[model samples]
Target: MSSADQSHPSGNKPLGKRARQKIERPRAILAAALDEFMLKGFWAARVEDIAAKVGITKGTVYFYFDTKEKLFAETIRSFSPNLASESEPIDKNRPVREQLTTYLAVLYEAVAINPDAKRVFHLLISEGRHFPELLDQYFAEFLAPALDRITSLITSGIERGELKSTGLASSPEVLIGPAIVANLWGIVFADRHPRDIDAILTTSLDLFFRGLLE
Candidate 1:
């Protein structure tokens, strides 16, 4: 190949292999780290094994993440749904009950039904005490944002007089508590005893709406 051809490579293609690898390596590391963490849990998981899974050395992993704790935290952050961006669309024109049901259903799908979310939740429950800072990070980045969205929905409903002044808007944790319990049930029980999750959520939502509706 001529020097010009060599320099331009695929002509319009802007990135070279080295440059592309630099962009992709961190993602690759995070994916491998998540798998390793899920398999071995935090204390038992080894950075070298994660590196081997990515076909890189331990030093290279450290070069990117600097520490296993950092890698674990980043893995959770990486897989976490950006609730701010992925939040369910709420139509103000719709009945508040319908809007809330739709919103909670979407939240349940993301937090309970998603396999990655379950694994991350298990990590938090099992290892969070050892890493309080990471737990705080998870709350700040993931849970807090989701709860804030739910609070906004409830607050709007109350202001519009569609929902009763039941104090649910101020304590959004009450809204999500069932979801957290359901997710924990899945983690602890697995398929040993399966529950009809949808039916349960529907019944629960009906009772909740009855109390909240004006």
Candidate 2:
């Protein structure tokens, strides 16, 4: 049967002929590929496997993405939020405590909602040496800018006299590094309720603030 004959599990009707034959084909392939990669890991996942999962031919998969790496890159790219780009414009006039609280809250919520993405991220960080391009794309697109934002926030806080001058400009790592590690730990190991995430974030902010406060 053609991909059009396949019924979606969502109880929705099948896509129209044009959509199924055109738009839905690539999208469905990507969705299935994401599931496969998340479950199987990037290196282990195969194009044929994704094609099989999507009920499409391997040629169809190749039509959309040239290789497994391209598919994985697209999958990771799809998961990115507008928050990263928007974060730079955050109001520096806000009180440092309030700013930190908002920052931590946003980070916590982002990770909590996308647990699979967090898992994939952890895996990539741990085993990404095998795929240097994947590592480069992941860091250049996501991690480095994120670190820059945190460093900027800390610098602003110090300028406002809200935080002690630890000379974060020269050692940006010292201010936000622990929180990055903490966030990864929370993503990988913590099983706290979603509602309780705020409390946990608040506690982390408190500890961070105590150390940084003037």
Candidate 3:
């Protein structure tokens, strides 16, 4: 062995190769699983297909994720970028409408702009009862925190005298109802009957501000 090669005891195996392998193997599996899950619904997706997608044998997949269910949960948790962050409180110093608009733009990109994102939500709405744990993970990762942010924004806007009480202020669902509608529309009809997402947001904002503002 050369002097550098002698420094590590793994013969011809490169240094850190094992560590890299450990990380890359699971990641490859997860990436493949995400694609499979997106293409195939959670219930219909197969581990063998995921393994094939990763170019690995079924045994290799089981070594990392004990069951297909665990693999699916891990894949959704890791690869679904929508749940990555808690919603940020709006900038109170700015106009509430402007702040809300900016926040919604970012949120819209994560939920509406990304085609794959709606599939995850569709899975949750349709199959959440079966995979309750994954549903809970989704709520914790995305929905709950985002709802909290909306509630906070509405409360702050009400306090600042910038908004009027429309009886929907207490409910985050009511406050951000348009997002849900937009996401659902995109999921169902965007391919054939494309709609202007920007226009939807703007019109929703206009109607919302009119109702909320004094």
* Top candidate by lDDT: 1
Task: Give the clash count for model 3.
Answer: 1
Candidate 1 lDDT over 1-214, as tens digits, reads 5322333345675666676677779999998988899889988999999999999999999999988888998898888755665465667788867767877887776677777876787778888898898789888988887788888788788889888888777788887777777788787776797787766667777777888874
| lDDT for position 66 in model 2 | 90
| lDDT of each residue in 1-214, candidate 3, tens digit only | 5423432345555547666667678999988887787678777888899999888899999999999888877877774546334355467678876766676666666666665565666666666788998888787877777777777777777788777766655676664566667878887898999899768877877787777775
Clashing pairs in 2: none
Minimum summed lDDT over a 10-residue window in model 2 is located at: 192-201
lDDT of 3: 0.73
How many clashes does the backbone of model 1 have? 0
Between prediction 2 and prediction 3, which has the larger TM-score? 3
Model 1 TM-score is 0.81
lDDT of 2 by residue, 1-214 (tens): 7776766557587756766667677777777876777667777888999999888889989888998778877776666433564475658677866876676566555544455565556557655777788778767776666667777777777788887876654565454454455557665567662234455556766776777874
**Clash-forming residue pairs, model 3:** 164-212
Best-to-worst order by TM-score is: 1, 3, 2
Q: What is the lDDT of residue 22 in candidate 2?
A: 77
The lDDT, on a scale of 0 to 1, for candidate 1 is: 0.80
Worst 10 residues of 1 by lDDT: 1-10
Candidate 1 wrongly placed segments (more than 4 Å)? 1-14, 86-91
